[model samples]
Target: MRRHVAEFPDARVVLNMRSGSWALKLPFLQEVVGHSLRSIYLVRDPRAWIYLMLYNSKPSLYSLKNIPQHLSLIFKDDAVREGCPSVAPEFKTIQSVLSRSEANPALVLAHLWLAHTAAVLRVNEGLPEESYLQVRFEDVVNFPQETAETIHTFLGVPLSPAALNQLLFTTSTNLYNLMYEGDISPTNINMWRQNMPRKDIRLIEDVCGGVMKRLGYTRLAS
Candidate 1:
């Protein structure tokens, strides 16, 4: 980041990183950028987050079989020494859960979510309010323009009328392909309700219910 800023002094750099990757690097990044750094934390409802993890065509790092390797990569001695909070306890929790012969994918994923979210929260707690903003994924999909405006405002950047229109056009065009039958709608917000199995819903809630409630996502499964 310092190299990038040195090379392009006037440029605004936007980094899109998963929570785990972001947490691991945040300490070093803060040292380089100091008060100039701003973070926009995008959080999704755990149910939807887990549903996508299970069904997405691409392999996920949070998969029960894959998570140990993923965690090793992030928490390796060199990486952790960069001033990142020690997630050793979370790492052990995942290792112990994964060792269970009866552990199912959904249950493993719920634990992975807890660890990753906790890692990010631990790092983010040190950031000043002006340096951090949390945006819900549902709001971005349901109200693209408003979300864009909110993001720009948080970053202290200007959102011109023409730029805003272009942003919405691009977002809609990109999102169209991800929707069922290429239909653009906010229905994706509750997509897990229709496609995820009831047992899986209950399982995710059972594991993630406390944090889910704190994030203001109501549990749908009894």
Candidate 2:
């Protein structure tokens, strides 16, 4: 990442990471990112986040075997240091949660959501305030212009009218295929309600209640 950024002056790079869980476990990578790195920690309601990951791929739900293997792959990077055994006590917590994933997948997913996000929060603790921006996924989708402006300001770049319009237009146009039933809109904020079972919903809230509240998400009454 440093090498790529060094080649071009004024190049603002966005490294969109897919697996926050993997990234959270990799302290070496986080160290390499360094305190000077500017980063955005975008998160979603765990219920929705887990639903999208598990339900979106039919095969994923049926195959519990892939869960650990998929997670362990991030350790393969030579720069990532020795896996699992070397990680902090949090590694035991992750393993304990994952052990029951085969029997109660939703619970495990919710635990993972908290574990991964907590890691990011831990790493961001000492970073200069301007070096990091923690944004919510729903906000980006529901309030495009406002969110874009926040991001632009955080990056120390101008949010020109033309650029703002382009950002808003692209977000609305690039809807997730199959995952989204209609055009991009704030209405999707509650789409998880339709996809998640009540049991799973409760499990998610149980595991992620504190973090969800910390992120300003209101819990529905049981």
Candidate 3:
């Protein structure tokens, strides 16, 4: 969007970014962006964020092209698809990991999304008041029109009626599960309790728990 906006002489920045982008704090972002830009800092429950990441990790659900070229090993697993024509020969690596991991893919995703973004939050603890006003995805999903109204008002931009309608109708579907009809009941929320490798989950917790709890993760009772 920034690049698209840049083409016009009167173009202004309309940043649709995460609350934890930490751009304002980093000199690189601010130095490059300067006063010529404005942004909409969208945020969501770290849990939901992580869960979506895990769900998107499945080869069936995502395009490998979306994966950062630099994070090749990370997404190169069988989970990453070569493309629509067909998967490449080397796709088995991700396939095996998907098959071998004991963790429920959805739960693993929730935990990672939560842990990673919570860590990002902790990393940028004291940003200036005007830098970003965080908005939760949960709240927006529940009251989308109100959120849109708030955003339009804040940025002084007109969010078209069509845009508002699109927001209201977007359906939530689980990417990993077979295509079917059902609510994304959080019944699987803690499936990690049984299936995830103890060491990895422990590493996740130790690395992100302090901030995770601050953002409302339920810690296992000691």
Candidate 4:
């Protein structure tokens, strides 16, 4: 922090932690960064999270003790260094359910997702709603303009129409555009319905029902 202050004295540092809810784990972060610090918390559809975990488990899993190292690798320019973050991935509870012998990976991932999300929700209860903003990935991709305006407004940043258009164009571009392209597509919003098996989807809905409800996500009819 001291070095950051020395180097970019006039700049405000925006720290992003997508894997774990650092606010819940490190209460002091709020104090150290000061009360003026505003947060943007991104929540993905639980099914999407499950699909990601099925393919990439280890990196997506979080551990409080290794977060600093994880963040260092995450911020590295090298493609090989990037990885998803998780909190307490090695805890006995997670290990028991995600063991190698576990035949149902989706179910395991769903449980893990639920556990982590529940922790975040519980910890956030004490925080003032104005201190942070929660945005759904679905909304950001489908309604880029509105989402951008909301985010900028929440952070008290002035964004002109030109800037917003550039942002949208940049984000809506296809991923193949090497220079910079946005993979913002509505197709991914419910891609899980086609990809995940019915039983697995049911498992996620059953286990994560409460959190899903709080986040305003409708579940499959039972």
Best by lDDT: 1
lDDT of 3 by residue, 105-129 (tens): 4433443354345534653455444
lDDT of each: 0.71, 0.67, 0.47, 0.64
lDDT string for model 2 (78-128, tens) is 253444344434444656655564546676667667877776778557666
For model 3, the superposed segments whose C-alpha errors exceed 4 Å read 1-27, 49-115, 122-127, 171-209, 216-222
Please list the Cα RMSD from the true structure of every candidate, rounded to 1 decimal place.
Answer: 4.3, 4.7, 10.6, 8.5
Candidate 4 per-residue lDDT over residues 1-222, each given as its tens digit: 756655665667666767545746534555555566677778887977675545323354333234324334423443332463433332224444544463355665576567677776766666566677889877877788999989999988887989888767755664422212124456644666776677878888887888899987899775
Give the lDDT of residue 200 in candidate 1: 89
Error of 3 at 134 (Å): 2.1
State which candidate, 1 or 4, has the greater lDDT.
1
Q: Where does candidate 1 stray beyond 4 Å?
A: 1-20, 56-88, 166-175, 178-184
Which clashing pairs does model 3 show? Answer: 44-137, 50-109, 50-113, 51-110, 77-94, 78-94, 78-95
lDDT of 2: 0.67
TM-score of each: 0.75, 0.73, 0.45, 0.69
